[model samples]
Target: MSEYRAGKAGINAEAQARINSKYNDEIAQETLEWIQKITGSPANTAGDAENLYEVLKDGTLLCHLVNKFQEGSVKKINQSTMAFKCMENINAFLEAVKKLGVPSQETFQTIDLWEKQNLYSVVVCLQSLGRKAGNFGLPSMGPKESERNVREFSEDQLKAGQNVISLQYGSNKGQQSGISFGNRRQI
Candidate 1:
């Protein structure tokens, strides 16, 4: 999900040229400004914005955002299941782009940059709000807030196979007579 850089000479020079020409440094600059506004963060007039935007335009931004958002937002290990759900959405986005047609380097790179700068921050905010105590442990990397799992199970199914032990071992409270009758032999 890293940024995109123009590779060797074999790439369709016309296409690359078109992307470079159409996007230009100005587009990167403007997109960076937009990212700052969206995220409510300081502007990156520094080269960081341009560099990130290039990657966004390449079609790798979804993956990068998913991974980072997953890492920065998840507070516990069990949250991984939730993180995976978020990753699925990112995958869907990538699939949609593929179905449409490959994006121009400029377009993809710009989008990637926006995710890294703005969308990512939003994920972080969401993660903070969603955090809760968990029986599972935390990861070494960090919390992630990509997406939540929409998968659900029926309440009846969840209750099945559970060992509901009563605390009153010796007490007759709520005891059924069937077991007592079975214990007594018939005359």
Candidate 2:
């Protein structure tokens, strides 16, 4: 905790930040690996707080705290799935911002500056947390989060026989025709 006058980073806080940097990464990475094994889900900061708030509009500088599932004060990833972890992360981040006592309802708040200044420290610690063991990708969205395949086709696609529906009878010419509801007029 030296009193070096690091720019922007205050003197006292800078020392503590460096000291924290020493061990936080080692522990965080270990936890991340453990989380990956039990749940088979990677510690991904892929949504909401990490995505919207932590990240820059140009998709740069994602904040570390945004990854609540992995890096939150509360443990999120485990054998049990947290369906509400996204909201939890968002609330956690916003609550932290509010606690900062910055009264504003716009983009680029004090929190952004707070996060940016401390981002490297947090990121080093988090990245030091390292990745989970296996090359696991995102977890399955489960039945609720899974998307249903649409069985619709335009007139052209239908006749294209992407999915051919054969209707053959005993004595009929081998022919295929798409069902169409053509406009008909009667006199």
Candidate 3:
């Protein structure tokens, strides 16, 4: 009897999971249709709708959605006097996040995700989130894209890099300290 009850519980959980998956797939299909309609682009039917969520939640997708909203501003459903509900939802979420004093990073990862994407209202978000940044261990100031430089290490630089790494970690590994080397690039 106990074994039967356990089996039934497992089946119930599996059934619920299937239902959720089906619901999400339906939503993704509807969203794809809306995206096509708004962007006036060819519809995408490449993969399972359920798989679209992973690709649709990035900075690139956010910018594309904003552009679609702008281009499709006049295309409205249900006796429209305003913008699309999708844009409204984003604004609403932004407002809610602002009121909670949450950092903009909580919504988007980097400042580029806002500035390069032209996501206005970031100033307000920064003001609100800045007040609570320290509590969350997040940096108060976001660096610009140009400042994020990727430098190719010279052969000498690589040796120096290894030395610096050795200084920090070699002590733990019972090794001698790193060889002293001068920096060629500014820290």
- Most accurate candidate by TM-score: 1
In the range 8-102, model 2's lDDT, one tens digit per residue, is 45785777567545444343444444434444444453432233223322211222233423344333322212324433443344444333332
State the weakest 10-residue window (summed lDDT) of model 1: 132-141
- The local distance difference test score of model 1 is 0.37
* Model 2 alpha-carbon miss at residue 105, Å: 28
TM-score for each of the candidates: 0.27, 0.23, 0.25
Q: Write the per-residue lDDT of candidate 1 for residues 39-59, one digit (tens) a residue.
A: 343334333434643433332
Better of 1 and 3 by lDDT: 3
Q: Please report, as a residue range, the 10-residue window in candidate 2 with the lowest summed lDDT.
A: 56-65
What root-mean-square deviation over C-alphas does model 2 reach? 20.9
Q: Give each model's whole-structure lDDT.
A: 0.37, 0.36, 0.39
In candidate 3, what are the lDDT values of residues 1-187, reduced to their tens digit?
A: 1123333358766764564343334434444444444444334633343234333323233334333323432332222223244344344435445444555554532321221221222333333443443344433333321234687879998887665544443455554455346735443
Tell me how far the alpha carbon of residue 130 in candidate 3 is from the true structure, in angstroms, after superposition: 32
Clashes of 2: 1
Most accurate candidate by lDDT: 3
Model 2 misplaced regions, further than 4 Å: 1-7, 10-13, 43-187
